[model samples]
Target: MSGFNTSGVLSVAPARMLVPILLILMWYLGRLHSQYEPIVTSKVSSRLEEARKMIPSVKLDWPIPLAKDPRAAFNSSKLALLIEARPLPHLPPLILHMMAVIPPDWRFLFIGSNESIIGVSRAYSIKHQQVIGKLDLVELPPPWSIASKEDVFRLLTDSRFYDEFLTDVEWILKYEHDSILCANSETSVDDGLGWDWTGAARMGDGHFSGYGGLSLRRVSVIKRVLSFQARFNDSEPEDEWFGKRLWVLPGAKVASRFDDAIAVEDVYMERPMGYHIREGGGSLDKSVWGDAARRKEIFEYCPELSMIMDMKLERQRCPDDDGNGDREMADVQVTTAVLGEGDDAKALPNDAESAVLPPQPPPLPQPWKVSVTTFGSPLRTGID
Candidate 1:
């Protein structure tokens, strides 16, 4: 009995010691779990934060910026002036094309009548150009008319016109709606800026043959001439008036003949910077634009000329056409080729008095008509 009692006491003591050891083990395990739980939770939280950072958030109040003004990149002194009272359909395109071909440092101004101004400003491209400060549209008041060629001449010759409208302008590129710059031209418009006046050369060797249809003029030289001489009203055209004085004006670097011409008018050049088709080719010079081969070459070099010049399709050529772009009137066969029912198909005038009839006037030349919509969008004129 005593042995059994001692064994029981030893077993009980060992069991009691095991309970405390188990408790210690459990406390150690709980402490380790508590330390690792925060680490695991932090690792998960950090991963979630990194994932959230990968996605972008939207801000409702962000504002979009407008396109930068293009005129800031250009020289304010160089101005392109177009004065047209006629609401020509080609004005917007002609202006835009010129803007593209001319140096970017030049600004454009259109001083036009209400009809013409409205016609031009209706174009979306023209609106964009205005928004960017590259162009301006103005309607001249009374006593500053451009209704006729005489009126335009008077306006340009007047010194007050320049003082009022063109102050601070050093160079002026005067272009008509019928004129256009050739994109394929090897000579840039900037090269012509060196001369005081450069334009299409006239037919003869007259001094200062800078025809002003698509001409570049120096304002200082023009001001000098205007200071001393006033153009006689209803006299020669403004270009000629300026040319006559400009030739005699001291130290003016004017284009004298074809050698210095920047544009083609009556004379022909290999690759002129631009072309001035007078009255949309109704008054085209036979020397420059008459030859079939030369016309073909010009068209190939500058296909854009077709947009401004009056042109006929190849199939529209008259049956008796001459290769030189003219028809030999005497050689034309006006007689009916079809024979009558019998052999009495002799050539005859329809009326007995037809032989004595007065000569009829030639048909009016057709203008090259283009819709403003056809030019597609305005050229992307953003400077890189």
Candidate 2:
């Protein structure tokens, strides 16, 4: 004890205690840093918010196909066009242009957040007054607000929004704000988004590819994905999030060569069913949609551009057709498909087969009631 100085022993004991104190202080600082960092906090907050979100625990199984039934009703009702949007001057035109060209019969549900410039929808509806389709602009409130691109969480959970917006509607096409259907798009016999509608054999795995823009989702599939999307933690590149989340399902499949996503065969190779306005520096790199100078080039490939902003609410009668969009689109579809009955033609025997009247096509499917809603403001669209 005499050899070991008492003062030295006391100093050693204090040093050991300081080490624990420093560690405790460091742990507290680490959390404080995490709280202030927007990126770090956002990730944690989103996960927590996602956890708080209420995705129904129910499982949505694949609905049986009614293709064989003559009475089989396709999901023509409420083709909810869920347009992802942000605050952009061009947003209204983007919506209007596609609306003007695509069949007016389709229902449209616009999904945005507080940051999104969704006021245009109401303004357009008020100004035009004659546009059809139940155009609804919905700005989700906080904890559910998904109006920004960074709000990938909201987009992934959109099925829940759709659940509230669309009732009894079987199909929902989630198109980004930057997307628009080709004014003259079409699907030939074997060219329906890589689906013949005959069997899953031809269906492309859209879930693997992130082309949520053109992918058509049946409500059942939507429910399945929404239920699963809720439990999913990884949320980047929303389209791929859906692709990875939904594709694993028994019947979930997406087929498209759309940009910003993965896919099998290019569904509409050189000619996409729709257009995506994208940034530069990528495969098939060309400024599209967003570029003003290059818009002419885009128009060469997509006539829909010509219709944007140029749309007038008054019905302009087509010389060759009435002002009906469905009828006009059918003709355009037949013309653009480039192979509506090519297989039928090739299958025909070298000799003429007796003409058989194909069973009269069932009465045209009745159109569903279209409804559009806007938060923070009312969304009124279409002529009664």
Top TM-score prediction, candidate number: 1
Q: Show model 1 residue runs off by greater than 4 Å.
A: 1-73, 328-384
> What would the TM-scores of all predictions be?
0.69, 0.45
**Model 2: per-residue Cα lDDT at residue 75:** 30
lDDT of each: 0.84, 0.49
Candidate 2 Cα outliers beyond 4 Å, as residue runs:
1-76, 82-85, 113-118, 122-133, 150-152, 188-212, 228-234, 256-268, 279-298, 303-384
RMSD vs true structure, all candidates: 18.2, 31.4
Candidate 1 residue 357 Cα shift, in angstroms, is: 16
* Model 1 pairs in collision: none
Error of 1 at 301 (Å): 1.1
At residue 366, what lDDT does model 2 achieve?
73
Residues 1-384 of candidate 2 have per-residue lDDT tens digits of 123466665334567778889999999999988778998878999998898786657787999764553212323454546545456555667666656655555655566654454456556552352243246566666566454455655544577565665666665555555455664555321233333111111125433444534455456765776665463444465555555555456755554224423211223234455644332112222223234345445467676544322333333534333332222222221112233465542222233333333235459877877766567676765532
